[model samples]
Target chain A: MRIAFIIIAIVFVALTIAFTILPMGTIALIPVALAFLFSFFAFFKSKERKRIFSKWLMFFVFVLFLVIVAKDVFVKDKVVTDQKFQLEKQNSQQEAQKELEELEGLK
Target chain B: MKKILTIGVFLSFIRICTGQISPNETLIFDGSYELSGMMTNIAQVTMQTSVMKTTNKSYLHLSAEVATFNKWDSFFKIRDLYESYVDPGTLKPSLYKRNVYEGGYTKTEKYSYNPAGNSIKSESKRKNNPVVKNTVSIQPGAVDVITLIYKLRSANLSGLKAGQSIPYIIVFDEKQLRVNLKMLGKEIVSAGNLGKRECYKLSISANTNKLKGADKNLIWLTTDSKHIPCLIKFSIPVGVGQLSLLKTAGI
Candidate 1:
């Protein structure tokens, strides 16, 4: 039972990490919610040492999820937004220049 | 001089009212296409466009779904929905909404245009992040991506000769972009279930290299007054994607 719990915890953490890195958006919440539910189940089903281990693992997973969410909300999103704005600005200016050239040629 | 000015004003008002499609007219088009790569169908696309009136204002709704199926099960899905409220007289969009679900990720964007200030207030939400708010300046008569499509359909393209281009501005994903559509003359193009019809080809392009593989996007619209899009062909990194008109109604 202890081995199974460990495997499940590891898999859940890996999935959380993968989803966070990818562009899965709010779908990452599924694994996080599952991990929380599993931890709660393990806490009641196991005894003594196993219970303590499950508690610590759940805390670790929760923290990791928070970190991932923070990075996305504070860092990655801003970077992407800025890049998109810059690209659009460049494209608009280029088009304006082309229009000017076309008018000049007509003249 | 005063009499002449009054006559010119009356004529301009008449022109404005008759310039585009009547406010009561509605147009709807339904279509499907296959996206293939390496001689195999990788994804199937279904698209629909509805232009109608809502409480004295014209509204356009566009929805598209792309899905990949494996036998009886579906493996991948992407859904995009766009809604735009346009001013009937000026054909300018007042509000635009975009909701997209790609794979498992979901995003929603809403834009409210303040024509008096020549700016757009955008609210965007991705996944579970808090809504990001921004206000961006815009040019006069600027429209969103979906609205631009309908605007093109209603525009007066009769004066445009072969090789002539029309420039327009579009607000997409919180950024303003300038796009030019170059008329490529008329040709007969296959439009899937709609069959073969004479269409006016137009090339669409932006000024940025970001389009890379998707550069040279082309669309063919029917020559009739309805001006329905018959076929849209564009190249991707892997292969070409074509969306042809399968059915249309209420033009």
Candidate 2:
């Protein structure tokens, strides 16, 4: 049971870290909760020699939770124009106008 | 007999109304995605209509632009443009053009309609590929995606009963796709920046692989005379995305 708890805690922590890196930091809370629960159980039940590892794992999850919250609250998304795309759009409109003229002649 | 008369009276009282696309009208919407009750904005979409004068005639020019937010560009960039030139009275498309760039892929397509022959001359090009041209036969009233959206807005949908579907043939990617628009009734929905609006809730399904599930895609149009599209929820290959109206002008 102790081994199972450790494995689950590691998996959830890994998922939380990945979500933090991705744009899905808001969803990382699910894995954060699971990691906290398993890490708490593992820390209490482990022997004194192994308790150090569990304590570090718990600390890492807590820091990650704080980071996710900070990022979500502070980050703002903005849109920037691509000059190449804008130029291409201009050329397309010019060509399309010519095509429209030709099509009207056909009609 | 009384039931039939009652139904007729109710339908007449509904006062089916139609709208027209006025020149210089513009609508802007913010597209986002919801995951686990959290909303993440993805893109900004703009739709505008104007009059374009050719050598001999003037046509209705409809254009739409969809661009991903700068922050999301590093992950997946989308810069899409769709333009359609249609007859002002009929809303039948004369020319349709699409220039789309998603991530690293790029493609451009143009379809010119000939009413005399009931056919479309198509030219499509992809990145690092030669342009291909072909002629495809179409029905009398076949329209393109951009024109279809405008036509739907101008359509008198009040006659349709709840759950009734209207099928449309649209030209996209050099093929004619059958898209069904179903009436799902009316409800008050939240329109971003506009607050709550009484809207006509409708569902859309297409006979294409891109649309994942039936009845999953929804569109809400204001029930007022403008009939402006206030909110839209669509299913993408990855997940569901939503577009909420942000602003409008010259309605």
Candidate 3:
């Protein structure tokens, strides 16, 4: 059916997009493909006219784009252990400095 | 799948080695503990065999044939002896007297120490001095012999506390064997008469830069404050043999 063809085409496009993204992008794309499939199934079974089905497909495409963006925002975990470690060590150094200052006063 | 399983098994073994013994006390090593879990052929090897040993805290004194292993391509095969020990408990060794009568030459070493097994000092001689070559010296400041009278502070059969790696390297003469060591963790180990005991252990391997291409000794010492060597193992290119602690008790 024409609707089935659209669903398959959308899934292929989503998978192609996943390859260029992060390690987990392949997983993030699954929901988007499913959403496209659901809309296609709805369009085929609906008594509504072609124009109405077109609107539903458009809505799903928009939802898919949002998911991809949300994934990119949440999955990044850029971490700098070196900088954090230095900051922690700084706190200890400050304590040692205070101890030394007190010792100097005693002298 | 295979690699994952191997990693899992290795991790669990580490846990087993660490989880059973608590260091009631710790043996202090100034720079780092020396001697390794892996075998090292000394100037002499003493082969010990015992006929009788109690299950509780007891001691076994036996005589063994000391040996050396020849090596090729990092693999070791037992070779002719460089030196051998008679009584490891005493330094005045009963040497394997050499003779040329049978077109063969064999010699034994001398020395003896504690047979108590409850302390590092009591364990068999790590340094079997056959040639007794000038009590060879090296760093962190060396002297021929360094002896300590170790006291066993505590003993129990609890799974590893926060920090007890079974079969850990307790102590060594950096001046003698001259090898760097490390603590891997603990495990359920068999003792002479104690049936089985969970022990903290330490292991040592030759650092590539330290010594190259020798594979006869794989020393796995227990991690007790006593620094008991529950297992001293050696792998020949074709085979391996082990001296495991059967039972250990307070001295």
TM-score for candidate 2: 0.85
Residues B1-251, model 1: lDDT tens digits: 99999999977764554354543433332322322222223334444444544333344334344443221113344444565655554556666666666666888887777756388888899999999999999887778877677678776677889989999988887777889998989999876555788888998887654354433688898787666687777654445556656555444
Assess chain B of each prediction and give its TM-score.
0.78, 0.88, 0.34
Clash count, predicted structure 2: 0
Task: For all candidates, state DockQ relative to the true structure.
Answer: 0.01, 0.42, 0.01
Give the range where candidate 2 chain B is weakest over 10 consecutive residues by summed lDDT: B11-20
Give the per-residue lDDT digits (tens) of candidate 3, residues A28-107.
45545565655666566656666475455657566655767675566542212234324533443344334323323432
Greater-lDDT candidate between 1 and 2: 2
TM-score-based ranking: 2, 1, 3
- lDDT value, residue B180 of candidate 1: 91
Q: Name the best candidate (by TM-score).
A: 2
Give the distance in Å from residue B12's predicted Cα in candidate 3 to where it truly belongs: 37
Runs off by more than 4 Å, candidate 2 = A1-4, A47-56, B1-20, B33-40, B236-238
| DockQ value of candidate 1 | 0.01
Rank by lDDT (best first): 2, 1, 3
What lDDT is reached at residue A1 by model 1? 59
> Which is the better candidate, 2 or 3, if ranked by DockQ?
2
TM-score of 1: 0.58
Measured with DockQ on alpha carbons, how good is candidate 3? 0.01
Among the numbered candidates, top lDDT falls to 2
